[model samples]
Target: MSRRNPSRNGKRSTLKDEGMQGDPHAISSSFSSIAVSPRTPKAAHRMGLDDETEDVELRLLGEDERQQAANGLDVEEQSGHSTHSLSNEDKRAMVLLCVLYLIQGVPLGLALGSIPFILREHLSYSQLATFALSGYPYSLKLLWSPIVDSVFFVSIGRRKSWIIPMQIIVGTIMLYLSLNVQVLMDDPSNHVTQLTFLFTSLVFFSATQDIAVDGWALTLLSPESLSYASTCQTIGLNTGFFASFTVFLAFNSEAFATKWGVPHLTLSAYLKFWFVMSYAVSFWLLFFKKEKKEPLSDVDMSIKAVYKTIWTICKLRHVQLLVIMHLFAKVGFAANEAATSLKMVEKGFLREDLAIAVLIDFPFQITGGWLAANWSRGDYPLRPWLFAFWPRIGFAIIATLIVYWFPKPPITMGFFVFLIIHTVVSSFTSTVQFVGISAFHTRISDPLIGGTYMTLLNTFTNLGGTWPKYFVLKGVDMFTVASCKLQDGGSELVVKATECVSDHGKAACAEIGGDCITETDGYYMVSGLCMAFGVAFLVLYIMPTARKLQGLPISAWRVKMSDS
Candidate 1:
């Protein structure tokens, strides 16, 4: 294979990587770039030692330097001076880099969640298409991970190589987007050009930044600290998401022209402005360097090898259980995120109401996160119970509420209360399960195969939610299909199915939409039940260790290879 030019790419870094973060773009791009082969330099043998370049390029230490450092040879003492420069205050600069680097997630996430919501008003897609747009690309990023693993923008060593340039690229694109888009912060119709241009570009940059950020961060930490790193990663991401949703995306004034100086300040404009400001974090991130553990190269890059991981995940019993449960989790949880804004719009709820929902639920979500973190320290914190009992039981409770207990008017209060409780439970449950699943694969499986093994179950879950249902959404289609059936009592079957999907007597289905119209009560009820059942299987058959911690039954989860 032809090699990429070293001069054009820069001298390559020798440090490798451990895993990916949110998106895999950087990972996907890694292999495709030109690299300088790592080799021993002649200078190391000829000259005794050089300390000048040690601060930046010290990664490829000469044998003598390594031996000296390991042997506690004080070059500082021998030279009667320290070759190193800088003081304690200078070391504090590291915190600034972390803060700035970690800041990239906000604008990126806002742009991501914002694009679909703003653009949806402009383009007409089925409910399924809209839902798919928001969550689908996230899952597919795994397919691109290996590629991001291999490519590099510079050979200038690792930190200055692919990651630094990609961030610069992302910042540049975001700057361009901000410069061109006139009314990005306002609603779609106020846009100067077609809204699709703004949305499509925003999505691209956001996704691009995601891949790059995840790759860069993944390469910076050791495997032993991944759990802590992952927590930090999640916090950074969620914080960014919260800021974008509440502060930037939530337009509160009477009109865009009034609140923003521009006469027609659009949602696109606001988002572009945020991107311009937020992406500056990338430029700051360009300076820091931390050593990586493992790196992928051309020798191992192959379609078969990538697919082989997927096949392996499918064959394992424990892997299969994780995959199935994760899918249902998304299917249950995503429906809420997908439907929330639309729900707000329909009930004549103001954008502020949606904002309120986010605020109220966010704290609850945080509480749940803390609960999840608690599990990391103990034998039965939350993961075992989460995967064990919550999902299906939550499904059953929410189902009953929708069908019989509370499925009517007073829409805003009812919806908010339900979600606050629902999301809190889901968050805690998911956190435990997510981390638990990772621990199982990371600890029990071969290190060589760990990343692939973890992602395979993730893929199975993605495929479950990504595919659309043929019938109208569960609640709405029942009646419409019931009306269409001409067979003996086929029409009645649809009615019964519709009734089955909805709260017992409530007309929760949307008048204008197809069957799967979801109301607050109906959604809560169905999703809770589904989640509960999945949890039950996990507790009874999959994980025997689950009940010892909680009062749950020992025989509830699905059996796995590890269990046996």
Candidate 2:
């Protein structure tokens, strides 16, 4: 029988020497096999083979072998950190991360959900649309994301350095803004500009902080525990949003205003609450949170390389398709969302009533995230996303119809019930879609440059959700019913020839006998058009593209850019 030996390729050849099996020096040649240390230096010296340069042949394992070894280490490490079949570190990290995400949510909820309602009484829909641009930094965070990725404090931890400082700044601003909300609003002429400045700055800090938080997620949790990380995001974000939107808006209601002996819920109170929550997260992160230190080799600290990676990712054909879908996915909803509050206000719904809708939708949002995670696992991962796509289109269409034919009077019990159900169902499906896409993005993002890749994907989706509001809000005014002056230095009414006399600073027009009101027709027209585009996008781009890409390996999605 032939003796087994190391092959020319450097792999161990198959074992064939049965006679040598009992020899202590005989090597096991199975790929799954582990070898003991080379014959001790004593044995080599005894054999007169102990040249100083002929040290023990220590070869690095192949990539697959190395990966298997790493997996083993991960299992062992996880076991050591786990108790009662759950990882303590993972649970603790999840809780801490969720709190951090909730902190992020407070500002986001205000920007995306509450502020619109607060300003609706004063600003026209077009003016409201302009406010959405303040969040434009969220969509363009990718521009600075690479810098966040490439720079870090080694001692304080890469992600935490950014997170801690940004949190302090954001928290201080929130407190300062809260203290002067009334002062800022006192000048109705400068209200929009002041708000745009303050909130835009807030969002800038929030967006930059998000870059650090996201990068931290990569280092904080193992790949197997990533779903929990997503859970932290979805739940924490929704919770924070609920607090800011429904809870804060509830405070902003006339009931609260009457109780507090103020004209409206004091913005200072809300801001103070957010300030506390923001710093709580920051404090926890600074004092308690710890990151796993990776080797310097793992850190890519080059600004140029970071941007190059981002550009390369953007230029990928598959990613381009994903970006397009992301940019268009929420258009239908964006139009409705931009107009819903205004339409409801026109229907005499109070801020508290809208809070009820958010309240109804909150549970389903959390549930949808969990369901999306479970459904998107294993062999048919894309199935859940496809399922969500159809229902989303259906909801968009249905929501459009509701707006097109919304009743003139204050909402009835039946209509309110319908709105509740619709909010729940639509929020659930939308959340499902969001989580599915986010999970997909996470899966494909290179761990080597996670912050930039994830941020890019997320920013595109956010921009998609936001940019549509500009056109929708502007277009809705083009279909306005009343011709009159806007209140509180808001944008001029889109002057339509009408019976109402122009009267600035008052809701009522002299000729109309009551407050000048815009009809819901604009809501119908804008939403309908947006829905049509949404439907076309799903059929023409999303479905076909998803089909083509569904089962492809992650590596297959990689594009070879010239610069890359």
Candidate 3:
């Protein structure tokens, strides 16, 4: 005989039958039961369990636990299989998704990271500000993301329709740039606009490809493996960025090439190599890989309906708060992020050495992302993000100090070690903040409009970082007060280096035996201002708002759309 707990519908479940009375693993078994037996509306109604009852039960579970249970149920219902592990098909899809993301990262890496370093020597900061427009397409992709989501050739596949063509366009741009990149860089001051236009177009296509891949990822993996999509994206994009920036800089540098007994790789050669890779991957997707037909829930939405939904999402209060936050969140780090490395280079810290520091820091970035993912799976997902914010800003200030104290050319090994350590620490905090915020975004995004929703959030995040860069670069020159000193028979004359704004002016200055002396470096002022702004933002707004937002019920974040 066993005691039974009776339900409102007069249904009873005995402890003995459930193995809870005497089993040592009752807690674990209870969780298994909950995961395996999700409550449907019809079943709940039949059991006389109201919505209130369901809410009460849900409130008892932690957010992560609830998510896990929901994910498990989603998997079981969709695939009619155990939710313990991924199928081979799911694993294959993961690999394919990673490869696609890697392809997208190639041109983006060049535009964002490598090109600035390459152009810094020839172009003034003001000119570099114009070139930074190439990175804007990525941030502004949200404007057309809905169109990308809604319009597609059904026979060719929804995502594949955009991805394949976009990749091809990206490859073609790479090929075209391969022939002219050196020419553009050789006289960057005159051709900054041309280079900006080309890279902007390339990034435009790459951003569209990103929209497709993001949507495709939702359907590509089984629900059990859905969570891994972010991991794949982080890993793949970082790898491609590393290759284009660190590896390219290292091999392309004359000093590094000579030191390592390797031939210097030209930018054209690098671009050509990536172009081949891009074409191969794009063709493989076109001919060999097949897109799984999306479900009716995804396919039935019209372009108009999708756009309407996006508009509705934009209007939500929670979403509006998040968008505003994303738009301004990077203000604190803008100067440090955009100007520090370039300033270091201007101080004679070789680009090759900077690349090496980034190379050493890369592994820590990956590890930090992984660790942050784990830490974010708790009740307060944004805890890691908020916690890392101070340290990241602190490191930004430290970066300015490092740049200020940079040793003369041929930097000492000890100084290099110190630089590497600073880079790793700064990057680790950044990765943690990135991963934590991404996890929160994942938690809140509407699955019905998965691609558009995710893209909307991501666009703002990218914009937050991108929009400040141009201003920061421009501000460096604006705030700087420098003069060239020329000596004539021991009497020194100082002339403003306003004319030294271009490479030709610099050459002219040097030819006249004039030394450019900076009376006030704008880097220091901008760094200080950014740090102060970051601190103010953290204390006055971000901290309070984040705490309040994170405390909101999941339902508070959802939009209610009529099924008319």
RMSD of each: 13.9, 14.4, 10.6
- Specify the highest-lDDT model's number: 3
Model 3 lDDT-worst window of ten: 22-31
Alpha-carbon runs more than 4 Å astray in model 2: 1-84, 186-189, 222-224, 256-265, 280-284, 287-291, 298-300, 404-410, 484-508, 511-520, 559-564
- Candidate lDDT scores, in order, read 0.40, 0.60, 0.71
- List the candidates' TM-scores in order: 0.57, 0.76, 0.85
How far residue 270's Cα lies from its native spot in candidate 2, in Å, is 1.7
Per-residue accuracy of model 1 over 324-343 as CA lDDT, tens digit each = 55455444334343443443
Clashing pairs in 3: none
Q: Which 10-residue span in candidate 1 carries the lowest summed lDDT?
A: 25-34
Give the Å shift of residue 540 in candidate 3: 0.4
Name the Cα RMSD for model 1. Answer: 13.9
